[model samples]
Target: MRTVGNDLVRHQLHENRKWYLLLGALLIIFGVVLLASLGMATLSVVFLFGILMMVGGVLHIVAAFKIFDGGYRWLWAIFGVLYLIAGYYAFTAPVQTAVVLTSLLAIALIIGGIIRIINAFMFKPLPGWGWTLFSGLLTLLTGILIIASPTSPFWVLGMFLGIDILFQGINYLTLAAAIRNIPPSSADV
Candidate 1:
């Protein structure tokens, strides 16, 4: 019962399975390394974030000039300046930046979790509502834990990032295996 699209997908997946395997292995290795050195990972992320913010700030400033006729040109310039200032602070005081970022992350997670929990209830008639509810609950709990834990600012972001990467690697590996096993199309016969 395979359609043409399915056959095409199978062919493409089989052809690219090696790449997926390589990417998954690399990600898994990175995740493990990050987890092993949470402090270094956190600092590394902060430094990278700082650099990105600086780049974004510069872009925004350039964009402000590009859109000189726009009514909100001043606003854009202001935001760009603000971003530059923030980026400078991030570079100068990464530890403080991490704390602020982690706090923001916790707040966001809390808000998102609440929204998801509410949505889950609204979608209770759907087939997998329980999973949504569970995920929301987990997110809410993690946020709370981050806020409550005194040491969270130092390691939470790194730990969560590492775990996410590890899981992503696992997902890619699983996908690679599945793709590798895709049945050959009739044309292959």
Candidate 2:
């Protein structure tokens, strides 16, 4: 029986190779720029996140009012208010926000990497599964290093983000190559 990874790779190779290539190229370009301007890029990311949070809070508050007859509306309203406070803080204290956000990113990376590794193992015997495992391990290690050093440079956040994206681009390129190299029929276990 072919694993889900085999079917996914086959489908992507046959149907979305161009999209994969485009995404990989775009990520690589963006990653390079972020790495080049680590401090500025980190500030930009924090600012953007703040703006998004403010917008989301406003939207949620508006939506809560729109839902006239539901108890859930109150829950939404509370969340909206909390979001507003958080968003305001983010804007007012961007450097602190960046640090907190970076910590959250590290936690997310750690969790996501663990999940990916487990998923990769589940797709065993499939072609390129090792690549997925390797990517997951890298991600896990990066996250651990970030968490271990809270007093690192401010630019660490941006550098980490850039490195993560670069790896993602490489992973995409690697998957594309693997899919292109192996025929669908040959992927079956």
> Whole-model Cα lDDT per candidate?
0.88, 0.81
Instruction: Quote model 2's TM-score.
Output: 0.63
TM-score, cand. 1: 0.83
Off by over 4 Å in 1: 1-11, 119-130, 185-189
Spell out the clash pairs found in candidate 2: none
What does each candidate score in C-alpha RMSD? 3.1, 8.7
- Error of model 1, residue 22, in angstroms: 1.1
Residue range 20-80, candidate 1, lDDT tens digits:
9999999999999999988878887788788888888888888888967576787788888
Top lDDT prediction, candidate number: 1
